[model samples]
Target: MRIESESAKNQWVTAAFECMLDGGLRNIRIEALARALGVTKGSFYHHFANRAELVRAAVERWELEGTDAIIALANREGAPAERLHRLLGVIAGSSAQQGRGELMLFLEASDEGVGDAVARVTGRRIAYVAQLLEEHGVPSGLAQRRAVMAVAEYHGARVIAAGTDSLPVDERVLDVGDAIRFLETTLLAP
Candidate 1:
């Protein structure tokens, strides 16, 4: 595709992602996205062959924004502990809507491309965490184990945060903050 069309394609991908966040993966039909974008389905066809292709693109965009971008932001800090702090801080700040949207994406990941992208992003995130732990003087094997636990904790927090609307916002934030602090201390301890 031409550069202009590539930009248009990105618009479709972004719009689809927003729709998924507002609703779920089932909301990403070409007609729905086109209507949401104030474009035509013809425009979607120009970018994607089908809804599955658009879904794959949306998943890639999610991986980029949700994982790769966070890693880059965290890497700006010099010390490993500082990076972990920055990483957790950023992740914790994401809205509950985003956490729920991510859960929905994972739950709806039936397409081959979507599943592969999810797996790749998950592994990459764990590996990045493991590297950070090792940089903090954690043993290689132990760091890997801790990294898995850390990722699991982060996801678990997301799940809880997404489901805790009945609680007051401040209390929910405090609860998540407590969990993050505990994870940091555990991962950084000698």
Candidate 2:
């Protein structure tokens, strides 16, 4: 569409993502988003063909935000370890609600309509991690293994952080960054 219209579309997609993060898929109603945006359902319809289309757009946006933008930043910096450190730091600062919302998105990705897009994003992550490891002088096979381990580490850390209430989840998240840093130093160091 027109440039101005595209901005509205982007705003709607961003609002849908926020809805997902705040309250899962159930919170992504047109009326709710319209109210949050100080607009009307007609505005949402103008941007999206239907609710499913909106959901797809939101997921696509989230995937790009989580992967592509971060990768671009890492590549631009030319310091793999430091880039990864910053990435993990961002992850560690995320709220428990965000972790839950991410888990929900992963589950929803299993649906037939969304599966390919999610899988593509995930595969891209693994490949990117493997490349990073390889650049550290790791053999290809080992790099691939370590890449998977890295992803597992992130997921495991989030799972652990989510399951505990004895300490604040944000406090637990600090351990995740520390744990990943340990892996970087001991296992992934060049």
Candidate 3:
């Protein structure tokens, strides 16, 4: 069963991504997503050749929105410190949605594409952080190390929050904010 319409295809991809975020890779079953979206399995087959292709599309959407778009937003004009501050602020604000990327990391052993996508996003994020650090006059090696540490702390917050969504959103955001502040004080201190 096949259908036509690029918008429909994108809809499937978006739904798939949302499903992934909601329940990880295992939640990306075609029938489940179709039922969730109120669409038929045929519609999914039309958009994606198979489950793996849909999963790839879903992960790609995650990369675009979660990684590429955020980096672009943080690249806007400002002093490096100001920009980094804004970046971290946005991250802390989005603590509720933080865990999907960390959850996706579990797929590294099972799905090569997911593993590669996660790796690329991680590297790109680390490089962006290191670039900002260098712009703030930190030496290259130190900047790289700090960027890695900073990213670790940020993603660690995500992983930790992933399991605690039952708590109030504010609490998770505050926890992430505290972690970010500690990272800043420890890494960005004079």
Candidate 4:
């Protein structure tokens, strides 16, 4: 059952991500991850040097797979507001990116290494949002402020959406227009 190769590294990282979602980083023990994946430490060490390396790799992978992917989504197709709206559309509790997992990841930002990664992701998201706003003649400071606010609201909306426990994740589409209007349009309003 052991798949020996770089794919093993990816499997380990993916397992680590799921473990982190289950109980944050502390639950991501090598033995436990192996148990969860039905692998062994031998399989793990074949990919990562140690637990710390695994943790680092997990965060990097999450950064690339989550925030970077979202930013890339935002950068594609349509105007800034439309792009932002599309980004919000998928996150409105419809995806893994929209629930307790992300909150846990944000909470884990206190960890030194993870903190740097978290900051990098958050800053990139805000900077990208701000860039879109700035493109519309919004002042730099206001654009930045709105961008931060937008992110906060985005998370808050997800919390509320997920809290209901009634809507299927895919059905939890928070209105992207609200975000676009507040974050993008209002700034452009004369």
Best TM-score among the predictions, by candidate number: 1
- lDDT against the true structure, per candidate, is 0.81, 0.73, 0.74, 0.71
Which pairs of residues clash in candidate 3, taking residues 3 or more apart in a chain or in different chains?
A: none
Candidate 3 lDDT, 5-122, residue by residue in tens: 6578888887788877766776777887777677788877776789889888888887888778888898888998878887887776673553654465455426535677777888
Report model 3's TM-score to 2 decimal places. Answer: 0.85
lDDT per residue as tens, model 2, 72-174: 7667765666666666566556677787776667766666267777788778878888887787678899888888887777666667666657755566346
Candidate 1 residue-wise lDDT, 1-190, digit = tens: 1224648888888888887776568778777667667777788888788888888888888888999999999999689999998998898888778877887777777643477787888899899999999999999999999999998887776676666558544443567678679989999887
Best of the two (2, 3) by TM-score? 3
Model 4 global lDDT (CA atoms, 0 to 1): 0.71
Candidate 4 deviant stretches above 4 angstroms = 93-98, 158-190
TM-score of 2: 0.83
* RMSD in angstroms between candidate 3 and the native structure over all alpha carbons: 3.4
The positional error of residue 23 in candidate 1, measured at the CA in angstroms, is 3.5
State the lDDT at 140 in candidate 2: 91
Residue 121, model 3: lDDT of: 80
* Model 4: residue 4 alpha-carbon error in angstroms: 3.8
Consecutive 10-residue window with the lowest summed lDDT within model 4: 168-177
